[model samples]
Target: MPLANLLTSLSALPESGSRDAYLRFLKSAGDAALRRSGGPEHVTGSCFVFSPEFDRVLLCFHRKGQFWVQFGGHIESEDASVAEAAQREAREESGISDLVLLSPGIMDLDRHDLHAGFSCSAHWDVGFAAATAPDVEVSVSDESEDVRWFPINEMPIQVPAGFGARLERVRHAAMSQSGTQIG
Candidate 1:
């Protein structure tokens, strides 16, 4: 029942080819979507954090991949919802506070080949759109090499394989849904 609301929220999204697939997977797997015990694919969450004015976006240089990425990671057992997991991961990874969720449903869904030591063979990533205050400071966690904001135009050059496209989708969602917007 923990994932019931998340499944409901995801059900509200205007499904695309990829989102439809994620929904199908969730329908079939249920709570196993968030569990990693013996499975190769598991749920992960992340937020595309925007600056107050919505121009610059926050990013972290992952210690593992050594490239810039939106703040997010594996959803833990304590995470009751994918949205909460995404907000928590963004706050923890970016050191940004008072981040507001722009949408309650899944903003984006992506499947990637994850070779990270912490994850299984693949990641079924659920993303949320969030906005942070302008004056907030960022702390670089041990999992990251650095934390900083980048212009949308210059943000994609070094983003790892799956991130660039996902960020773009979140940016579009934010702009459409958040009134002002950030890319």
Candidate 2:
């Protein structure tokens, strides 16, 4: 089947009521365009990042696929807000006990190519804040291979699509709240 058609079909499926639902949502959404590419549904995920300093963010290196992504996921139920879920998922996955969910609203949705024959939908990412030193130990979870902090200007190349811009917006919001200038 064409990738886009496959993704549409996958998205139309009933939610699996598992962690996999978020993954499915991402795979379907990201690959919606791939129906034209003649591919299949791929894995879905949620990702987030933490700003530990004024100009740095924490990121995870996913073991499963070895890609760098923010902390987020698929919508689990109709009850919880996507942002709430994103924060909870990030805390669980990254073991960052001191993080705070920074909010006005969800920042953005992003889509990207996935493995095998599938594409993914917008990863519903929610950004957060932390005040720990840059080298704080990150207790890795099964979902991630490794975790580390990166300076804003020195982020990894594979940092999820749209993340840089979103982080910039988040920083601006924070700066505004603090009555400071961001340049």
How do the predictions measure up, each by TM-score?
A: 0.88, 0.59
The 10 consecutive residues of candidate 2 with the worst lDDT sum are: 34-43
- Tens-digit lDDT track of model 2 for 70-166: 6544434331444455566667667877655654243333445455422442222324333345665678788788878778888788765666786
Clash count of each predicted structure: 0, 24
Q: Which residue runs of candidate 1 sit more than 4 Å off their true CA positions?
A: 116-118, 181-183
Candidate 1: C-alpha lDDT? 0.78
Highest lDDT: give the candidate number.
1
